[model samples]
Target: MPDPIPATATPTLLYRCMTKGVKDAPESFEYGASWVTARRGMLSVHQDRLECGDWTIPYSAISQAVLFKTSQMLIPCYILKVRTATDSYQFGLSGNKFWSTDLPFPVTREKGRLRYSAFSIIARVILIAALIWYFYQAWA
Candidate 1:
């Protein structure tokens, strides 16, 4: 276990992420079409607060932190879910540093389940077929 970051220290970690949901969110926080489209942002972890876009959540307000996995475009995606007394926030993380010991709370990890939508499945099939044809033509 790593020591918790001090309040004055620089952010412990930063990740490229998409905000997926925000329950009981602030008025200025926009969550429109987040489920359908990517809302790219940066998630920064600090000793005191979690900053992402228009939201700044203090660790004291966080009731739970969970790390789980989902999929997008047939690719595995890691999700960080942070819950407060009255609010919950979900972020789809990018890059490899998905866990940190500097967090104020212990993050509960869940088993990953691959979920493929019809569109993604069809697209994957088409991509595989195209690759096979390309290889075959190249060999011929």
Candidate 2:
């Protein structure tokens, strides 16, 4: 028998690599863990040991999903790529059943590329300018 699923499991817990949208949104779940579950179909994500925000992705809004390998060295792992009309998100999943889902033939083709936003673009520009200034000062 499968181990019991915790009440805090993510929305994709039921269908590991689901491409099909449910007729209605799933139920909300909360746990005694540090993170708070504000609504259904949401996930708590952590960055740099700090909780950034909850991933409350509506089931009907998910246009596509992709499973890809992660860079973890200890073991071969995979994460789920969720794409909506306005945003794209990634989620660390526990199971390896993503390939079984009926994804597109090309799997949406959003992986392995640098996705830059306004902040990242500005950062890169600042970095380039700083490097040029440093070189000019050193030469002069």
Candidate 3:
């Protein structure tokens, strides 16, 4: 039903970070800002805190991203500034792990035929075990 990736190509996950922002902003952004997720090649922005709506931002759309840091008294503040073709977004987040790294990274490990990741499989098993333990405790 769908085209498969070429055998020569290996999918690599570079970096991921969570910020707060939205697109086509309103009168005030604080109220409209939501959790925005940034991955190696994409950014997922939820419209509201509940994730009622969303927008996907590809790395190509991003023209520039600036990282700023300032210390207040004894504390430090971090900010991520990203400029797209049509808009600018500032997110208050700590750490510059992504901003400091080189992009379009190559895959470090070989992948299995199945698409499921080892972490996802582990998480599922942990969740099931927790559920079972909860039920057993309730019954006992």
Candidate 4:
């Protein structure tokens, strides 16, 4: 018989966003540049590098990850809350709906969209400041 699914385990779903023939078939779903981690019990995921990041509490923390195959392609999948057996686990964009996978992210709450708009404004201001600084330095 298959192992029972844990009750505390939450379902997180990610959608694949890859276009055709861009990524090598073998390494298409795996990420080389970025990774994600979920703070225990918080439904939010944060991006960080593999080596220089907080230790993820294995099997307890869940992360929904997607990697760029190109700017146009994405490989999305749901990673089961699993204990880290090895030093690193290979993340694959498997289409498997193992253990009753459901998209943990809710459809409601447009908070992210609003937050991104705020970020856009802040970024514009920072760019403007940087330009001013550069020009001043050049004229000085």
In Å, residue 139's CA in model 4 sits off its true spot by: 6.6
Q: Give lDDT per model, in order.
A: 0.60, 0.41, 0.42, 0.30
lDDT of 1 at 97: 44
For each candidate, give its TM-score against the true structure. Answer: 0.54, 0.34, 0.37, 0.21
Q: Which ten residues in a row have the lowest lDDT in candidate 4?
A: 106-115
Best by TM-score: 1
Tens digits of per-residue lDDT for model 1 on 63-134?
A: 887877555566665667788887877776642444533445567876556355555567678999999999
Q: RMSD in angstroms, all models?
A: 7.9, 12.9, 15.7, 15.5
Q: Residue 117 of candidate 2: its Cα lDDT?
A: 52
Candidate 3's displacement at residue 55, Å, is 3.0
Comparing 2 with 3 on lDDT, the higher-scoring candidate is: 3
How would you encode candidate 4's per-residue C-alpha lDDT over 53-82 as one tens digit per residue? 233422233232233211113433333221
Clashing residue pairs for model 4: 16-76, 17-73, 17-74, 18-73, 18-74
How many clashing pairs in candidate 3? 0
Candidate 1's displacement at residue 35, Å, is 1.9
TM-score of candidate 1 against the unseen true structure: 0.54
Tens digit of per-residue lDDT, candidate 3, span 6-105: 3234233333344454444322213221323322122322221111124444556666655455433445544444556887655544344443444342
Candidate 1 regions exceeding 4 Å error are: 1-34, 70-75, 98-102, 114-140
Superior candidate under lDDT, 1 versus 2:
1
Off by over 4 Å in 3: 1-12, 22-53, 103-140
For model 2, what is the error of residue 100's alpha carbon versus the real structure, in angstroms, after optimal superposition? 6.3
